[model samples]
Target chain A: MKEIVVVSGKGGAGKSTITAGLSYFLKENDILVDADVDAPNLKILLEPELIREEDFYSGKQFKIEQDFCIMCGRCYQECSFEAIEIVNLNYVIDDVACEGCGLCQFLCPVNAISVSDKLTGKKYVSKTKYGFNMVHALLNPSEENSGKLVAEIKKIAKNLAKEQNSSTIIVDGPPGIGCSTISAISGSDILLLVAESTISGLHDMERLIELTKNFKVKRKGFINKFGLNHSIDEKLVNLFESKEIEIVGYLTYSQNIPQYLKKRVNLPEHIDGYKKLFEGLYNRLMEAVG
Target chain B: MNISIVSGKGGAGKTTFTILFAKYLVSKGKKVLINDLDVEEPNVNLFLNKKLDYDEVYIYIPEHIKENCISCKECAEKCLFNALVVAKDFWLVLPELCHSCKLCEYVCKYSAIKGSKRVIGKIGQSFDKMLHLLEGRLNIGESLTTALIKQVIGKSLKIKDNYDVIIMDSPPGTSCPVIQASKDADKIIVVAEDTPFGFSDFVVLSDMLKEIGKDYYLVINKYIDGEGYSEFASKNNVKVLGKIPYDINLAKNYSFGDVEDIDTIDFDNIYNTLLEG
Candidate 1:
């Protein structure tokens, strides 16, 4: 079995676009994983039919009960996050800022604090329109612990792949070199970085490459929207080569992307050069992973 | 007042629109401070082309004193983040996993843990006396995005008196870091697009803004002909701010130094409208 995670350090660098295209092209008993919990958009492209949805509990949130409060303000003073604030003569914890350290709960003089399991996110298993199983997640907006959610969804995808007796899982990763990106690509066999040919793209790509350098995974680079600037494109190619990452494919700029985006269509499969681009990438990826 | 430019999706031109407003405010004889809270990869200085002086943001990760340790694993057992891996002889601290909550240091019975600061990111400051840009760039392989963002906010707040307006460019996704940046803003301008993914995510984003009690305006970036962005904004009960047209020439030339013609986006009224209210 092989798992290939597509990541781009910068968002909107065509990570999901490329992953959806590649997954649709290789719709042969492969399990698709959408690990962008904060903004999971793969289902929009694939129109996945939900099979099951489950609540995900990652951490506990501490809340102060106003009824039992004496309002000593000790928690407000001791909190590092400043999550506790005086509200209507009672201290309240801002869930967004609260680090869930439990220090405030321990310090409350009247013991007005209570801890409860936080519903951090939700996990879903579904069947894509392409007849392949898909595992995805959606983190509650303004929630933390996305890395944990990504790891959980990846595990579910792996388990589903095992049950379906599939050998390949195409994981759509999120942006930023943060916990979610790390979790998505950590154990994957092949890491395909889909990057654009722009200065911001190049700079962030270098950081993403640096982040994944310690992991023992075969790395591949695909410069999506390449050929925009010859110099920038060339620089990206050199950066990829210097990292010893195989240059699997180069997708030139295509107007079909935004036009199809207007038509609410993802996976620019019918564009002039997309078929060749994705075919070359898929072939190179399989060979490299094998 | 501080305004945060945020987006549900990436490449919605959040930075582009922010620069337009900041530059426009400066042209109007108003002082502006721009804080790039997109710490994972802060590139505001790239477009401004300014030589910035940077200060490192320190995050305290525990430094274990192995000699003072009893292998009781109390520190490891009490860690909420599981950052401490208690080996057969010593405890290993995975700096990436550490949330810097000071819980491990608090629980160490043998005084085995010491507080230490590591550079997780850098805040770059640049200005031309009228417009100041604070670029918060997270160090490579670091996931302490919210910590750096808070630091950037802190640094920018100290200089808030110098500027007539403070504009923050927030990171993508409706996550904790976004909330951290959004909570401090007087107004949040959500730069979105005219696609299903973009519109749906904007809806989700507005729900978050409501939960955080923030008033937001929608600016559909890359506005094209026959897109239902205005309709979507109205349906969602969001105020339409302004739209930056889709121009390939502008995108091609975006790599060059400073932006010159931000008025083409027709954002002259937003400054007064958002400020006066």
Candidate 2:
């Protein structure tokens, strides 16, 4: 089995739109994984029927007992995260800022602080409307450690692929070259960078290419929304060529694209050229991965 | 006062709106300081044609002292982020995983660990008279986004007296970095594009803002004819700040890094509305 992960360092560059379209065209039995835990939108396109969900726990959070607490202020003084804040004359942990480092628990002289598992987010396994098993995660807003959730969902998708004898795993990765993007790229056979033909898109894609150098994964570039500017599109194509990345295909600009996406309609049926574009891109991807 | 421009969906014109609004404020005789908190990409500098003086930003991670090593695995065990690994034969440090919590240095009994500053990103600032720009740009492959944002914001606050308003262009998404940038903002403007994926992510951002008790207004970028943003706003009781119409020329100008004042948004009216109470 092979994993083909799609990432665009800049968001709203048609990563999910392309991924959903290609999933419909790929002939192989594939499992879909949405690695954008902070903003998972693959499910919005390929509506999923949830099979199971479970609480995902990672690290630890400290809870201070109000009765046993003496406001010694030691935890506040020692916490590097500044997570311990005084609220209504009571010391409370700001879960958003808390890094769960256990420094506060160790520094508390009153023994009022107790450590418990931090409920980070939820993991879901479902059957997508595209007839593929999907695994995705939703990290609570303002939560850290999104990379962990991405890795978790990818792992679950891999195991499910193994059980169901799937051939390919299509991952819709998050924006930015952050921890989550790194996690999504890990162990993937081919990293398909879905970039748009704009200056910012080109600049962000360059940063993402720098990131991919750390891994030995084969890279493919597909410029979405191409033809917006001939100069910018040429610049993007030159970038892909200079980086030795294979250019799979390009999708020209379309106003109807967003309209179709807004209505959650399948793109192949409504969008003018996306049907042929995705089919050719899917074939090229399978060829590259193999 | 600090007002941050953010959109959950990137490439949804957060940076474009920030540049245009900053120029608008300057035209109105408001000394504006623009803080580009989108460190991962930092596109504000692209549109602003100015030479900036840059200062390197660093984070201190535990540097192992190989000469003083007793190979006691205490420091590795104490590391919450698992950035350090010490065995009898070898020791390693993955700087990317290091959170810079200083726990490793604190736990080392034999002085086998020392704090060392590594350059993770840089802050660039330039004052063009009334319009001051401070931007944070993370080095490629670096993951410490929130740390750099915090430092850039700290520096911006120090020089806050020079400007009448500090407008922060926050990073996209409703994540840790976004939370850190929003922590100090007096008002937040969420730019939501009129698309399905855009609205989906916008709803997520709105939920996060509500959870954090931030007073935010929405601006529909690339506004279409029959979108649900207005209805969603009324249902959620969020104020509609202003909408930038969907113009292909605006997008074309953005692609070329040109910032010309367009009649698409009535910035003066929005400014008046923002000033109320």
Candidate 3:
């Protein structure tokens, strides 16, 4: 199956809006994956009903056996992460600060610390009203390993596609060119870059484009809120053309986006202009994948 | 003493704050080192107008040697990221999927797995009399930035003793890179705005700081007239270090790399408050 990931370099670029609209245009059996584990909002627009939920564990959680503990401070000194501390003549492990690197457990003279798995987040497989499977997740606040959660979401999406004989997998990737974005684009067939027209937007887009080029993925651009700065929009178009990247569509600035957010509805329903633009962009993506 | 200017959300004026802080320190005749850990979009150089000297760094991933034919599939089976796929005759390593943990090399029974380095990106540095700038750039397709950021921070460590204070402009979000940049900071100033998104992310960042035992203060940028941001500050029990009102000329000056001319408004109070604390 062909997979397409839509991502923006920074947040507030109307990525979820475009992804929601694209979901409406995709085939009935295609799988949609929301890979933005930090702030997964595509499900809000799609309104997927949770069919299955599972906990995602990435690393170990350290627990101290207080009975065997001596306040030698060896674990505290050996821990590079500063997870161990001496409190009231007893050593304690702060689970949140602990990366579970196992340095303390190995170096502990008393062997008071033991590592165990802890649930970091929950992954959900849901059924959307659009007749497609949607896989998304929520990482606990301050929890690490968003990249690993993103990979797990993709795996579920791929498996769901195979089980249902789906033809496409649509991924709404996280913003930023970090580990989460990397995991989103690593194995994708095409990358759809949704960029804005602000100065920082342009700067971040250039960096993201550089990152996408490294992965050697076929890329296209969608300029969201192009009217914010026409000059920057034109400059971006020129840059994309010079790089041989296609501009799929330019979406004009409109309050319809924020309006849809308040009403918790899809873009195509609230804005006629966006409806047409999304249809065009969806068709172009299909053709590109074809 | 490396200090990073960070916030939990984007558009919190982190770059603006960094530029202003650098200028403030420069005006005080103190040598400062500014490293833009925001490799995804390094804009400090745009405001500084200084040329950068770059050095490339590579993240090594182990490639299995085919000659040592042990198709045990141990590497693939033991892999948590599923980056290695072992076929009946051979194994394939997806470099992009690899997290560079080097666990596969350890799991190989036949010693066939060996690591090879691929240059993912470069860390660039520039120097002015007032400030030294180090910026990291990830290769266009490279997925791993934590490694590159580590390199940038590692290089910045060498000159920490040279300057009285090292200021870092960190990337947005509370991810690994952000954590890495803020790991060794003596103090963190979270630049936040008076918006709901900004408030939410500030809370998340505050939780992280509290957990990590890092002392932090909040600077509300673009403080409007009668906005009651002070009340928010009071409720959170975080001191409002200083406020820069909404000024178009100040923003324009910053965008054009002329921040040094914008009068240092309220920075003395902010710095004093930090120093006193």
Best by lDDT: 2
Binned by DockQ into CAPRI classes (incorrect, acceptable, medium, high), candidate 3 is incorrect
lDDT of 3 by residue, A138-162 (tens): 7775676788899999998988898
Q: Which residues of candidate 1, in runs, are more than 4 Å off? A: A266-273, B65-70, B87-89, B108-112, B226-228, B255-258
Please report how far candidate 3 places residue B142 from its true position, in Å.
3.5
Residues A1-290, candidate 1: write the lDDT tens digits.
Answer: 89999998988888888888888665557798988888888877788999999999988899998899887788888787888988777789988899787778766778889999888888999988878888988899999889889999989888888887898999999888987888888889999998788778888899899999999999999998787666788889999999888788887776657777666565445564666767778888999999
| DockQ, all candidates in order | 0.62, 0.72, 0.20
Point out the worst 10-residue segment of candidate 1 chain A by lDDT.
A264-273
> Which model scores highest in TM-score?
2
Task: Please tell me which model should have the higher TM-score, number 1 or number 2.
Answer: 2
lDDT accuracy of residue B239 in candidate 2: 87
Candidate 2 or 1, higher lDDT: 2
Q: Write the per-residue lDDT of candidate 1 for residues B171-250, one digit (tens) a residue.
A: 99999999988887888899997666677677778888988888888888777762667666667677777777776666
Look at candidate 2 and tell me the lDDT of residue A96: 82
Indicate the worst ten consecutive residues by lDDT in candidate 3 chain A.
A254-263
Candidate 2, residue A286: the lDDT equals: 93
Per-residue error for B25 in candidate 2, Å, reads: 0.6
Q: TM-score of each candidate?
A: 0.95, 0.97, 0.76
True contacts kept of each: 0.52, 0.62, 0.19
Model 2, residue pairs in steric clash? none
